[model samples]
Target: MNSMSVWEATANERPKRPVLQGEKTCDVVIVGGGFTGLSVAYHLQQRNVETVVLEKGVVGGGASGRNGGEVLIGYVESMRSLAKKYGRAAARQMFQMSLDSIDLIERIIQEEDIACDFQRNGNLLAAYKPSHLDDLKREQQFLYEAYQFESKIVEKEDLHTELDSSFYHGAFVDERSAIFHPLNYCLGLAKAVERRGGTIYEHSQATKIERVTPDKVIVETHNGRIVAQQVGLFVNAYTTGLHDVIDRAIVPVESIVLATEPLPPALCQQLIKHNRAASDTKRLLYYFRRTADNRMVFGGSGRTASKRDARTLFDKLREGMVTVFPTLKDAKVEYKWSGKVGFTFERIPYIGQLEDGTHFAFGYAGHGAAMSTLLGKLVALNMLNEGDRHNPLDRSRLKPIPFHSQHARAVGIMKYYFKFLDYIS
Candidate 1:
């Protein structure tokens, strides 16, 4: 299999923007050109605010462009779990924001005229074990009662209608969840930002962010610097070394993904007839779906701490794909790749402003596609001094993760523990 992302290989052509050359100034300086940063720029331009975005690489080169392309609703944790942890009223607001995030994505796609193969077929959450069927049922009920969103649950007997294989015990399909070409969407957003007179500099990695004063900061790149009233640290997984507070509060883990060569149209239909984006009920979940071009793309949350583990991830992913769809034992994996997901101990995304007047938003864990885009709007509103009291994520500042340096080892131990549990279940 090739060692590259399918999205990168098949994405549409766009003009290459120039790099940062000299010092510049803007009202707001956004670090990282991924979804969050681009979204921040997009929303700021809506209010005609002068903004500058500095990306280390091309736009969407991070998780924003390299994810599973599933525009899902809700957090990584379930609504019931959120309610139990943060009260029902808080959970309801968070759930509503997730729904609104999905709507924002659709609106941006239509308004910007971005053609990234956007589709609303659906997203199926599959049960990996027989006992997990009840969990899916409860989730369906909770979605309907709490959010008024109805999802269809399929039992083992009728599961074949949704999935071709018998690997899953049952499943629930959310009609509102959708999928698209993520990298293209990011590229489209960048263009849209430029069209609105917002400035963007590619190959402009911010190496140091100096808080010159409480009210303003200076973001320095390799070749230039930025003087701004405030800075937004939206780098997500790449936040390490950018700022100590953000890096300490977050843990970044890598997940590998693979895409098979185009298969027969009939075989593709037999694999996933509805073409829904599907993920299983596992601690280290498996996400799989059929591409618009008839390729079976599969991915999993497998940690790669070293170079050796990175090599093994490809094999594990292939084994996983075959186990789910035995018919694909002979299918060729044309592309293999990986990206980092920002995780927090609390298991909830945060949007907070540091003491230096720098605003930030991250720790999506595994769900960042729509949520990252939504955070851009919230952060922008905060930048504009518009009331952000409605934003549930803006309640308080973030606390640092305990033993941040040992997070990798902790995650490795948890992986083995969860693997053992999965084996037992």
Candidate 2:
């Protein structure tokens, strides 16, 4: 069978609907029906809180569907950075929250019967240069000693047997991480939320948000308006013009991905021997892994700043994949696509409230599949009258993006500069 397009790969396969018509009122209104919005609705509905989720497109239609599907542990950046900024104890708690995200994901899949192809194949973080080996070693040591996590190191000679890539000098395998079908997972969450009696409207573009009072927010869609007691803006890259405050703090960069035709069992064995999700240790990097059916799902950004063309980006990704595994030269690429990833200056995610009764979470820094889900649940918990003083992951510690007005020009330039640095280094 031919590989499915990214849109059809693991779509919910539900009938698309037109915009919502009429006025609606809810305890809480969520914008952007991706992982975050779904999680919020799911958890809030479970708590018997009246909630409605509005999406401009279908569930998982945005980056939620376009991601690489790596269910990784930890935040966007290294835990070392967390320790540097906060204390070691705070960093440990933060790291534990990430680890807990993986567990929560697996539990949701099993308990909710989500058919997302979740697997425990683990993740392999490979180092491209010799200098990176020292960093990998330090990372491994830190994971083991400081974080109480275990990772196995693969030397250059052993890496070929495991990954069949000549570009890396060493690699660290974290057995705690996992991978899954991101779109399927997202759709499953949406369905679970619906099953719990929460309403979800697609093609429902939220154009206006007004603060009716200090505790009441009004969300206006094209066809209807929602008088929500509280509002949650889970929108990421698409936050542009929707929320002026969030748009300034988040930078949207393009992330492209491609999939090759299914390979023979022997060929898969020769390539990624363990069928692990693998990514190089670069800021702007390439991440490739074997699928359940033995296809090479490879992805990397282009030489240009943004992912403009699907065909051209796929061609560049094909070259990168072939460079790593020469045997795939004859293989046909079956799927290709791209999506926007939101990032902030700190490289950490932006999760907090605009003010009282308005919660927000975005800017995952290109790692959103699990983090988004986790943050959404936390947001729901925070909304349900939880004690923020005790919980370390409360919304207070995370700050909003700085210089919020200059985000478009400043973030674009920052992304281009980062891409340039990735090219040179």
Candidate 3:
């Protein structure tokens, strides 16, 4: 839409609040007000827990607000890779968790009456090469057999109706996936949390942490400090200078997106007939979909925030869109922006307690829209004396990614190189 960027095009706008000053105490302290932290506050407040959330900026001002808004049915990483790393059953469990996360998100939006422009349109996992179909075929079979889900595999000729892209050879359509306005979702969740007695302080940055005991943590922010028995860090990409362990495991991978002007009805119908979102199979991939107002929102990799200029990157994003719909080559791009995504070498979200009393849930690896909120609920439940039965995620073996410090720079370089490979391969 011409209204705003896809991240900002949503109808809901949050009411602002002043930052915290002086000192405050709470039963639990949460740093970062993105989807993860907001979900933590929401769940904790529902249980009548005294909780406070501190954000360096507005709620969902981080990757939670800056993503492509595709709530897909699987992990950010491929299921084949996950099965190789964690075994088949674990991979299946992880996949099930993602599906459950999607359901949980929808439930929260309906129960809270948050108008986030959410839709249940299925996602098309298209294949760019013939070899890529191998993974998709295996995935479709695995999903049906292991997860009891139905997905249709379309051949190359059949893909024309679904995707105008001649590049894709085939695709697997998963009806369980959906899309939504992520920023509005975060804002609505934060407001609900506040309405339930949880306090959220924006522009309040957590600078230092003091472990009062094995079970208590005191978090010091710029203007105030929070003393609590438990603390949570949901700041993923922005975790720089906060914790060395997190900094090493998490690298700030830049993702850029461009929003085109609302297309005419005929063009919109030609682009996506059923209003489904589509993302191709590639290592360094391109994810694009139409918004509620018919504007195309496209996203992919970049180097830096400033270097990824909107004017220049908008052309690049439009090129990808044109590859999907050749007629949209001359489409007008209205807004372009970029945000940092925290990526771990392992590509699995790491949720565990630090040596101190701080409990951390991060490294969603860019598929956090659903998983982050689910993790927030688990984090709150674990902190609120919930039994292991109530906790769905397996956190017992959660550990930080390895080879992160020295290998981080190399990983970035390798990522760009592999992106090029995917582009050519």
- lDDT at 218, model 2: 86
Error of 1 at 259 (Å): 0.3
TM-score per prediction, in order, is 0.97, 0.92, 0.93
lDDT score of residue 364 within candidate 1: 87
lDDT of each: 0.88, 0.79, 0.79
**Model 2 C-alpha lDDT per residue in residues 151-210, reported as the tens digit of each score:** 888898888868877877889888878888888898889889988988899989889889
lDDT of 1 at 50: 89
The lDDT leader among the candidates is: 1
CA error at residue 391 for candidate 3, angstroms: 7.7
Residues 359-422, candidate 3: write the lDDT tens digits. 7777777688878988888788878767243232444444456665565477568877887888
Q: How close to the true structure is residue 221 of candidate 3, measured as C-alpha lDDT?
A: 82
Model 2, residue pairs in steric clash? none
Residues 145-255, candidate 1, lDDT per residue (tens digit)? 987888898999998898888899989888877889999999999999999989999899999988887768899999999998889998888774888888898898888
